[model samples]
Target: MIGEGVAVRIIPCLDVRGGRVVKGVKFRDHVDMGDILERAAAYRDQGADELVFYDITASPEGRSVDVAWVERVAEAIDIPFTVAGGIRDVARARAVLHAGADKISVNSPALARPDLVAELADAFGSQCVVIGIDSIRENGRYRLRANTGDPDNMTDPDLDTRAWVERVQALGAGEIVLNCMDADGVRSGYDIDQLADVRGICDVPLIASGGAGTPEHFLDVFRRADVDGALAATVFHSGQIEIPDLKRWLGEQGVRTRTGSVAS
Candidate 1:
């Protein structure tokens, strides 16, 4: 943030469950907020550079691609969006893209196949692939978390976050959306140590998600590590922080951002 650098994006995340925007902490604090299209339009008008639509219910239900509603939100917003959760294959990825998503984010699918990322990237371009890696702090060290979506939880299926970051990049991942569920909806702050691990291992652009609760939280993440963007749900959705105010604060903190004329 101190020098000339790549623009750090203020990305908004919409964790959609049953056609409603929901806020949950470590995948636990599920709160039905509002309609997806309504929130997407508000953020687009509020100067959000991009949006991420996550089907938070996909995991528990065993289905994916909230295609109908995704299309609606995409049609309502001018900025691009990255859709994730339960996108298991290229065909499904294509369906979401056809629905108006600018990018496809796959977490469990890529890890299960490892080749899925390459296939999707080869099929659609690298920029269209965003791999979500959930990491958490544990036992005085940072570790990659699997399946739980809660950063604090861990299981034997876990892979080393940094090691997999390198592997995913080689597998043709264009960017990594590092999310720490422990910080999700907590409004505390991002996992700096965890973000540092991903930032250190990832060569492509990195997006830091989870733990953003205030305007100062945005500045804190970028200042602590080299990240391409910041993604938040509760704060932005609850009106605890506004995109325009976040950008202004980042600028004051020496972080460069898209200086567009905010529509709101």
Candidate 2:
């Protein structure tokens, strides 16, 4: 599934908080990293397949995504970019797309109103709608967690990750980004079992996010799990793993990836 011109993407994430890129451990205690536009351009030049700008505090703050920032980032980078956080309805999604984002991702809002997923897909096409699932493992099962809370304390027993993935896909999500709440920023590795669970059931492009510490972690997930792409912030942001170097390594190991120009 990897070789033979099939490209696995390496996406650099910009977790924006207060209009700046930040990194947090397990979605808490975030520290400012740097300017968003600067980081976006740098990643684009560094050969990132795509850029994902997540307003880390938008949904919690209950506000619309920053269209102006999206416009600026789009202008600075040549690769496809995605904007998520605080996008609740068709109008907001449209605004983000109009601002030059290639896609709009929704997390908490999609859970609150699943219909909005279909609505956005209908208006902007399914390719434009990305369903971001933030999941935490609990009681030996993966549970959905939106906004913020302790993983042990938070658990939606009724809606497991697999069920939600199928539901969102059926609801019109063109892509699924599975973010591991437990592994987020842990730098250990991705939740392989959980990702495999969703991957086995999901047909759309699946992006595995969270716990990317070493390049081997990326290789492991792509090899062990049925994921199309892998996303990481701290590793890329802190210069721990260079995109070109990572791609080269993957290519050397027979893993196909877009090392030049974004794959789209």
| Number of the top-ranking candidate, with TM-score as the measure | 2
* Global Cα lDDT for candidate 1: 0.81
Best candidate according to lDDT: 2
The digit string of per-residue lDDT tens for model 1 on 211-230 reads 88777778878988778898
lDDT, each prediction: 0.81, 0.86
In candidate 1, position 47 carries an lDDT of 86
Clashing pairs in 1: none
lDDT tens digits, residue span 1-264, model 2: 434766888998888877788877655788888899888888888888898998877886778777888888878778898999899999888889998999999988888888999999999999998999988888998888876523333435357888899999998999999999788878999988889888899999999998999999999999999699999988898898999999989988878877665435
What TM-score quantifies how close candidate 2 is to the native fold?
A: 0.92
Name the runs in model 1 displaced over 4 angstroms: 1-5, 149-156
TM-score of each: 0.90, 0.92
Q: Model 2: clashing residue pairs?
A: none
Give the lDDT of residue 134 in candidate 2.
85
